[model samples]
Target chain A: MFLKLNEIGDKIAIAASGGKDSTVLAHIMKLLNERYLNRKIFFHWLLQRYDYGLDLFLLSIDEGISGYRDDSLETVKRNQLEYQLPLKILSYKDLYDWSMDDIVKEIGRKNNCTFCGVFRRQALDRGAVMLGVDQIVTGHNADDIAETVLMNILRGDIARLQRCTFIKTKSEETIPRSKPFKYTYEKEIVMYAYFKKLDYFSTECIYSPNAYRGHARVFLKDLEAIRPSTILDIIHSGEAFETSAESNPTNVTVPGVCNRCGYMSSRDLCKACLLLEGLNRGLPKLGIGNTEKLRKKHLDEKEKSIGEYSSSKRTPGNPFIQNFNDLKLGSDLKKPL
Target chain B: MKINLEFSGGLELLFDGLKQTSVVVEDSSLKNLFKKIESELITQNKELFLKDEKLRPGILVLINESDWELEGQYDYQLKDEDTIVLISTLHGG
Candidate 1:
């Protein structure tokens, strides 16, 4: 397992959330790099390959939550100073022009997690691309992964159920992200950090009640208390579930690029783009659940609004509709607004 | 006996945002201490810390900087000046 760090790469980004798991992960990786990686002699360089010392960077996403993320970012900054690693902090306001605080205000607390989860996933990828790192490592421990497996199964999300068990998730469109603490229990992480006197932030997000995952996590923890191996067993069960295409035809989705943001998606618009559009249009619930029906209603309203504008001089409110107008009326509206 | 109690991973929020507080209590198993905290120290959301008359499933208990699981869990007898840390893993990383 020690050799696995050597193989990951020269430049890696740690997705430090300023929490116990990620803080300890950063500390351990730095220790390994200094004590082991720096002293290793490279024999593969004889075959025309050059070797370099390990480079680590701290990447944090500021979801723009006031009390939660703001305080956590302070801890990340301290970690950068302490660990001597380059740190990059990205915010949703910068990436998507919407912060979690703004999202919660616009959409309320009910479905804000949907937006935060989708946006944060892409925000990390965007941050990794900006850093030009070889790989991104997160602080997802065994408990988190097992809870995700249970959630996917409960939601009947077969695609995510198959993918959630992976220690490393890589695809053509995304930066390869791995969980180094995949098998480590949360208790062990907290204990290690406490003993080491590592600095970390440990406050829940103000906007996240997150009842669904909380229930699943409680259930998993209860099972773990009884058997102690139930977490890994559930993960193994998730890994063992094999659904042939014939057996699960509806869940299969071909990966494609979103036309709006050019991110990977099964449809023309990715979840982030769709949610952003809904928020932009003053209809924050459009992308939450049963989007197809809401989307049809939106399109019908757009068509009626377009019919009212006969001059073709007026532009539509949605950029997507404006794109259509730009293509149809190529030279008409190009007369400088 | 006096024991140092450390609340973290958002459990401090329930304890008026106080991370470490030394509480005076009689020598007893760690199980009895749960009630002492819920009644005296914890200000709200007792369910987050204790559930089903036991330490909540997601809450981790450590005695003297070692996992409580290693020291007989709730059955372990408390010692004078022992550092007991209660960390809630329910928070997001």
Candidate 2:
């Protein structure tokens, strides 16, 4: 019901993960597209009917986790065939020159989810830009939003806590991303998929065994079991929270483009650029946690290794060439002098 | 008593990647049927399917294509050749 399809503009893409929620979202949108275009007279009385010939496509991001992403991509392909919607698959390797597998190898399993989570958010935006879609919709259900609200509160991340409950998020620079299933229940999504015999991939990431969100999810699900309304209750509570300016003094700053990749960033380098630099320099921890402190450490390490340019030189052994320059990603990092 | 059980949404992994199985139970109650399936059918990750002698919170139970919540959840009576589907909603979105 939160889809607000008419406001989503003509060209739209669903950020499908091939999970049950996204699969259900894709299927629903496809069905709606058919009805909205083919039977306009039936919905003529509705004030918010879709435009003529509504365009819908599925956009998927391949994080390149071995056993996880490859299998899921197959499901997305099948969905493409079933829904008769065009599909565009973009890989982390193509976008960032680092797969989740590569990130895990360099940084170990501890904080790789950070890399993936950050990379995927931007990957979806970039993919949307490439597709020239007006808006991107994700299958983030009420359960997901509620869990995220709990997580933000638990982590005391007031910034995100303030922003997590919105049904649609928009900024001037990027494509608007919205949640069509904002009020939908996770159980309902799975049931729809099951009853329809929709194909979906449903495996946990092998590297995300210890993700912090998993704990929040289990806790939320437990609460949901006890009271089915807990999911929406949490969301309502999050929206009702009037975080005072006394608690969170808003940081007012103009957003600028990353010097390295030209992505929108408040700082000179975006998070992805910083993370990529860490991976390339063999200092995988450089981009994670305490940015200023890590930048100091990275510069100190670069100073210590100045005599050896081998670290800066792209590894001949690693087959995926750093395509940062090719993609207008990392054209600005000067060689260690 | 006999029942058909189906697992999906990654619960199949706990059943050695098997999606469906038929098991014979000594009783006609859902609880007894789960106990039988737990002992006979489940090959790995029993905890994912059950916790503290109950179905895990994230898993949804359907009795003959209806929501188990509406059908008495884990206490529903099982008839001969009934189909019960257990789907795990815990996977990534």
Candidate 3:
């Protein structure tokens, strides 16, 4: 693989998840740089702080929960000390002041993984952008890609299925994303790590009750049980399949920026902004639920006022009543606006 | 009017309402069928449907192998044998 290092440039950032896959990826990149690329490929490690409370879960305590108290801190410290590479640690708290419990509860509400995935991807992109990197590399091995392809095909996710092929790079974005190990397998990565005796976290996240992936993994494993080459066959099939570019459509960009949070969205208010509004209104389901209730409430009040005015037949000379009606109309108009 | 509802990928789900269940589409579009299914699911498992915030993330609803979000809204047109697959996103890296 070091022979291929000449094709890659000097400025690269390896997305290290502190797991076997990413650890091996980082090591491989480093080896390529040192052995063949002449150690010129300047690399940085970006780690996301997913506050799973794994330490608490593992140790069964919640007394100390800050940065210093984090158990992963030692591992990160050791990595930084050994590798001498700059490591950026990003947390959800830094992005949004929500506890792990709060996030889990919120996600549990929809049973949707979109929130976390979007947030993490955005964080990684933003972090990479801040670090002034040209390209970002992730440890998305062949097995991961194959699994994703299978998952997409199963769910009939045409867009994802189409886009899942090859090295994806969004030039319009601040920093482009790539996967050197996109053609590599998870088992190969594990074997490489084991062969080299690399230090990495083996435990799964305490909260990852990943039912879907677990099912897919088991199915793949079962297939592999009958034929070990099935994994590579799936990867080869994925590689051979040509995704038509015209069929896949990107997200439609909105004209205006979000008033609350300046994230790019199709509407004037993004989902996060709407969520914040729900939080502010003390009704978390305000945006999620049937919005007709909120609209009807205003309409009902307006109808009541109109009925009262029509029945009372207020005199044009009555200044107090006129002012009161003006105030009422103003308040009613202000509700949705 | 009896249409097949199949999930393509290897998603092993123990659906409570859909037991060898084939639905009849009299005058409803595919979107309407999904609405019916959603309502049925809600009725069958109110606890799951009630948690809207957590449900939207990572869950992709596909009608006839196309993403509902990309195609039409939830009310997109439906053919007789169009399969609707609900896929939950993988969490681990």
Say which candidate scores most in TM-score: 2
Which order, best to worst by TM-score?
2, 1, 3
lDDT of 2 by residue, B1-28 (tens): 7788898888899889999888876656
Once fitted onto the true fold, the runs of candidate 2 whose alpha carbons sit more than 4 angstroms away are A1-9, A41-43, A47-53, A244-246, A249-251, A297-337
Model 3, range A1-337, lDDT digits (tens) per residue?
3213212433566676655666776776665445543322332221111111110000011112243214544554565566666776555444434334455565453533444454456556445544555556777877677777788778877656645755656445235666778767665565465447676554344455567776777687668668978767876776676546565444333345443344445554445544434443344554554556753553344444433432354333311111111222112211111
Q: Would you estimate the TM-scores of all the predictions?
A: 0.86, 0.89, 0.54
True contacts kept of each: 0.80, 0.83, 0.10
Interface CA root-mean-square deviation for model 2: 1.2
Better of 1 and 3 by DockQ: 1
Model 1 per-residue lDDT tens digits across residues A1-337: 3425335355789999999989999998888666554445645543223233568899999999998899999999999999999988878876666788888888788988999999889877777766778789889998898999999999999877878888887476677888889889887888788778999998777888789988998798778769979999988999898888876764567888666556678886678877877887899887889899987788555645534332354444433222321222112222212
Q: State the C-alpha lDDT per candidate.
A: 0.78, 0.77, 0.50
The predictions' CA RMSDs to the true structure, in order, are 6.0, 4.6, 20.3
Alpha carbon lDDT at A194, candidate 1: 72
Candidate 1: stretches off by over 4 Å: A1-8, A41-53, A249-252, A299-337
| Ten contiguous residues with the weakest lDDT in model 1 chain A | A328-337
Task: List A-chain TM-scores for all predictions.
Answer: 0.84, 0.85, 0.66
* Candidate of highest lDDT: 1
Tell me the lDDT of model 3 at A147: 75
TM-score of 1: 0.86
Fraction of true interface contacts that also occur in model 2: 0.83
